[model samples]
Target chain A: MSVLRKIWTALRGSARELGDAVVDANSIRIFEQEIRDAQAAIDDSKRALTGVMADKMKIDRRLAELNDLIADDEASAVKALEQDNEALALEVAQRIAKREAERKEQFEIAERLASQIASLRQKIDAAEKIIADHQRELSIVRTTESVQKATVQIVDNIAAQDSTLSSARSSLERIKARQQRLDDRLAAGEVLARESGEQALDEKLKAAGIKGEAADANAILARLRARAES
Target chain B: MSLLQDMTLSLANTVFEGHRFDCLPISGEQEVLQVQVSGLEEMPIYVTVTDTQILCISYLFKKSELKEGSINELNALLLELSLPMPLSSFGMVGDRYVIYGALALTATAEHVMKELTTLASNAVDALQTLEPYLK
Candidate 1:
């Protein structure tokens, strides 16, 4: 009976430890998703920044060429006007002035465009930094999670060990209970035999003005029965 | 006219209160004018001065959008310095005016209010420096 009880106790302990392990596994999955989302956002910002910079460079170069042409044309018109070629001077001056006006307009347009480009670049840079910061945060979170999981696993192992010890302890208690019950029955039988043997002695002692047994055998038997029932 | 000095004095007036400007001293012949605004969040306002006007080329703020009242204050300030409201004909690319201000994004009254304030402040400060050049 003791051997059968030990086997049942071991099975129950294993089942309880397995339940704890399943719970720990689920928590790790949630941490992994958070990391993935952070990484995706960082990638998107990088792509957008790259496209913006490329376009800005092209516009800048175009503006620079326009600026150089305006300068060259104005200088030529001045030189032509100084040479006393009235008709040629007027045409050159007018053409240079028109181009200069166009260049000025283009310059203003370019300046505003450049300002907008710079602002966007700043935002992209800030976003990129934020993403990097989040990545670092994710790393720390993941590391902490891993350590927690390890700790849980160690705790679970300790719990499993404790469960086995508890099972062994319970089996011992059951055995002790069984032994106590058997001992009570033996004691009852001995008491009955002693009572029968002492019946003659009791009648003899009654003449000497003393009771045969001071202790109540029936009361002791009742106590043993109550203990066994409990 | 030294473009650098003109811009620096303008920026100094806009950012620093009660700072008397003697004259803008030119450091070198460069397109970029770097103005240092001293504070916990030290902002560097960059300016590019041209023949016609001074453009607040770029400025950096942490993450918040600019507010409209702030923009109005900036415009008023720039008006005091004779700088006009920056034209929107400027195309945006990266952290350019449009993107940083979220100009291309869905426009709400609140959003516009926020963006305009910062933009106006930056433009006014930038144009203040260019005022001499513009005249």
Candidate 2:
């Protein structure tokens, strides 16, 4: 079966809950095992390919030897016929025919072995691709697990600290509060400085025997309008 | 040496694109690099490099943080959001939701840094976008 199908099967079998650590761990193990199996299958195919290649080479050598023998025998037969020796010529012709037949047989074996090697090589290439895919998937699974586990540690560490790391909402509120505090301090400082200045001005007015009332914006505007009318 | 340890050492002195990284190794069965990026210090990116690929993850929130009855709605919304988001995807690691990106093992340090930056910023964006669904 394909690695994807195996993973799908495993996933289907364990899709009952989110964050099922056990199932995820088991799936990761299965994926690793599947990758190893694929590598082994590729190795087996390579070994088979080498064996067939060796056989093809052997047959190729035999075919070459047979060709040489056929050529020599044909030449000998020609020489025998030239010398008017019919029996010797016939014998050499028969030997050449036998060598030709052997060559044909060896050539056929070599062709078969070559085809076998080609298919094996193709299979190994495909298997290698599958293994790479499996490895990629396996790493994702393993890394997710690591990240999750590490997060647990990190979160625990953070929680152990006194509000060092908090929720996003809390962090946002904290930032807002920080800015708000700065604004409040500035406003308060301005109000205090104005109050002290007003108090000193009121004391000076009392020393000069003049009573001062706090001026309102609307009252000042009414006075200005009255003066314009007059 | 482990790849995580090597990366930790190299990243210790790395200041990329105006952000400095502080790498810490999370102790466990497997090595995980917790990279705290400057400015986005709240969201740390977790990195693990395998033989085939490099995986970087930043936790957005936990399942417990979701408002009551918003799980399905949030999940659907996350699925829709994943398509338009570049270089990152949303996933759940156990109970925690994370934004993660993956790269080939041949990816350069610059690529890793880019991924980390994108992942960290994406995480903060995800939290803000999903705030309505959070309690």
Candidate 3:
């Protein structure tokens, strides 16, 4: 195949792989965004829980102050009753008893609020853990995406280098072919002329009283011996 | 003026008269011409010519080894022509032809050397008129 064709094919494959990697990376980004949103929600819930706990503490302090006021009024009621002020003493006792009941109810409500705050805090902690785990997962996905991008880039670079090398090799081959054709044409004529000259010289040597036949006979005998041994 | 057109007429005359090589004027890139000198057989010497340079780009001959005499002769011709000889491992740069001495000499020492010298002399004469421009 041609170099251009090969390069095109390689590029198509690389693009396909890169497309898949992009999709995976985008999916990871979506997961990452979701985790971030969840973490934000967890943070908001934690802030609300802090407010609930503070409110519960405030209610408990109010209940304690009401109990202290009930105690002081009750002591004053007992002294008034001992001084024979029955009506005043009765009114003070009734007020103290009413305040005590209110304090007890407030303490119960505060306990319930504290319980709700604990439950909400547990939910926030669980959500945070999930977000943290998702964040870790997102990081892995990002790392994978980075590696994939590098792989694609490396493949592209290799393909480019290969194409350049192939083009250089093809050019060199064409040059060599042209040189060979010229060399063959020039050498063929010279070789023929040399062969004829050699033949003529052999003929002259034969006519000049040189024993060429004797040398040929010896050469034939040597070839026969070598062949027989093989 | 472009180097190719400026030297076309002189280059044609020199190639035909001095070297007995055929000249064909080229049009694109520059006013260059291609010259072909017929050797012993159908093998022809190929060269490219312009006003500033005459290049023996290709030749035909065969030998396993190159001689030192041919190398020295090529260097001398390059000096006379005021052209840089191509390094063996380098490629062409612009209008200059890159060649390796080892490869040229190995292929055909006598023929390569002779053609190189003739081309070099022709180039020197053609570009001599432009010496003041160079300085």
Candidate 4:
């Protein structure tokens, strides 16, 4: 039995993993499918539950009629006995006994239907909760996937933009040139002063590189400082 | 007084509080201060003292040197935070993006220190935030 249980557990775990993979790879599609599935389940459960409730209502109506008939039969039998009509009284007594049997049957039916209605309501509640949880998980998964995609795209864009950024450096150079043209005060001879402003940081980064691999910004920064202090 | 002049005075005053910095001889016409921020490692910042503004820049990694496709996330984050960051912004310096702060020349020692501190702290935070994305 234990070995059988172990196999069952393993199967369940594998099935869960397979489901997770499907959800991860096609989260939106899975989410929509999940919504559709949950709605269908809810509809089915509602139908079943509605049938149970309708049975309960029908039994309750019959029980009410039986109760009224029981009261009328007792009153009529009592009146016949008081009038000294034994035959009439006995006939009423027979009808009263038959109704008593019917009332018992109707009562039993009502009780059973009531119990069924309660059980169905509980099942529906549980199913609804499961559906809600599925929807919540789907939302969170979609959000996380979006963030990951956006991150990848942004990195690719910048890597691709490296050449265009050199254009930016030239634009900066132009801005500096224009500034030089405007002021015409600071000697252009101090070219290193302006260009080095940008390149100093560049050189420092290059110094921190490990075999052309991008070094951590923090590590490169530390190296630059160590060089400065030395 | 010139922008560099006030910066020199503030540096002498140790106004940047705990951060380390040194004067730089341009390799040009603009006098610059190099500030070293200590975090998980030492980070380099180039401070250019212009006639109008003081630009404090911390050099990040080179775009060319990073493994292909590693920078998309970092770029996305920078783009997202650029506008919301009131004190500093990311700019391309050569092939690298540097986090920098711009301050008015007439700004007081207290103000300069604040700007420098914010820019440095943010750069460190950014490095940590982007560490996972780095290849």
**Candidates, DockQ:** 0.01, 0.27, 0.01, 0.02
lDDT of 3 by residue, B12-66 (tens): 4553323544555533322233444433212222333322223343221111122
Winner of 2 and 3 under lDDT: 2
Tens digits of per-residue lDDT for model 4, A65-155? 9889889989998999999999999998999889889889988888888887788777778778866776656544433233233223333
Task: Rank the models by TM-score, top first.
Answer: 2, 4, 3, 1
TM-scores across all candidates? Answer: 0.31, 0.67, 0.36, 0.39
| Comparison by TM-score, 2 against 4, better one | 2
The per-residue C-alpha lDDT of model 2 at residue A112 equals 89
Those runs of model 4 whose alpha carbons end farther than 4 Å from true positions after fitting are: A1-23, A26-38, A155-230, B1-135
lDDT of 1 by residue, B50-122 (tens): 3333333223221123343364554444456333334312212121221122242233333333333354454
Q: Where does the lowest 10-residue lDDT sum fall in candidate 1 chain A?
A: A163-172
Instruction: Rank candidates, lDDT, best first.
Output: 2, 4, 3, 1
Which lDDT value does model 1 have at A192? 97
Q: How many backbone clashes does candidate 3 have?
A: 1
After TM-score superposition, the amount by which residue A75's alpha carbon in candidate 2 deviates from its true location, in angstroms, is 4.4
**Shift of residue A78 alpha carbon in model 1, Å:** 2.9
TM-score of chain A of each: 0.44, 0.59, 0.52, 0.54
- Residue range with the least summed lDDT across 10 consecutive positions in model 3 chain A: A163-172
lDDT score at residue A98, model 1, on the 0-100 scale: 78
User: What is the docking quality class of candidate 3?
Assistant: incorrect
Candidate 1 Cα misplacement greater than 4 A, ranges: A1-48, A155-230, B1-135
After the best TM-score superposition of candidate 3, give how far the Cα of residue B66 lies from its true spot, in angstroms: 44
